[model samples]
Target: MPRNTLIAGGVLVVLGVISYVASAFASVTALIPAFLGVVLVICGLIARKKPMLGVHVALVVALLGLVGTFMNVLKIGEVFAGTAERPLAVVVSAITFVLLLIYIALGVRSFVAARRWKKADAISQA
Candidate 1:
């Protein structure tokens, strides 16, 4: 592996581990998607030499989803850190839902891209 790929993979592994651990203590389960995002990032880095455009698109969308989820979680955590309040929770939850919609859209796009890449690969191999 190239140095950059190694570093990127290592970062992704760390991100996955951190998100997994954090989810255990947080109200948000965003960690699960974050873990998936990290895996996609690692896959993307590994496949960089293969020129699979769809896989590359999947990686990019996963990365974006990860970042957006991270931000959404931060906002929720901030709003609920010291409160026993229900209103803040409701507001934050609403915001999270909206962000999730964006994440889902990107996720769908990524899957479509990955499927295209898979078909292309099959044709090439045949």
Candidate 2:
């Protein structure tokens, strides 16, 4: 999961850089993904030392990322319909949303499995 976090962060950083460049550096807003990616990278580094703390923080960030981008994700239809005001931004947001969502899902799965394993261990000890 730590590795995955780092990878996701790397991807987001790239996405933001590309978006910013694509906009000819006119829109600082295009760097939103880069900011988020930085946070994730930090979390990933922390997780390397403390998996529980790091992953939980990452999950929270991912949840927030999803919420922040939900509206933009909805704008996908508009982009496809050629009605989106800023198609590139919308696409970037949508992509970010997907990445966060996937991370959250995988994190939740990992959490559940860990919990079950702990419970089983406790049962065996008892």
Query: For residues 24-78, what per-residue lDDT tens digits would candidate 1 score against the true structure?
Result: 6454443444445455555556556654553554446555654654544545544
- Candidate 2, 62-113: lDDT as tens digits: 8999999999998899999999999999999999999998988889888899
Clashing pairs in 1: none
Error of 1 at 44 (Å): 2.9
Evaluated at residue 17, the lDDT of candidate 1 is 53
| Worst-scoring 10-residue span by lDDT in model 1 | 1-10
Model 2 residue runs over 4 Å out of place are: none
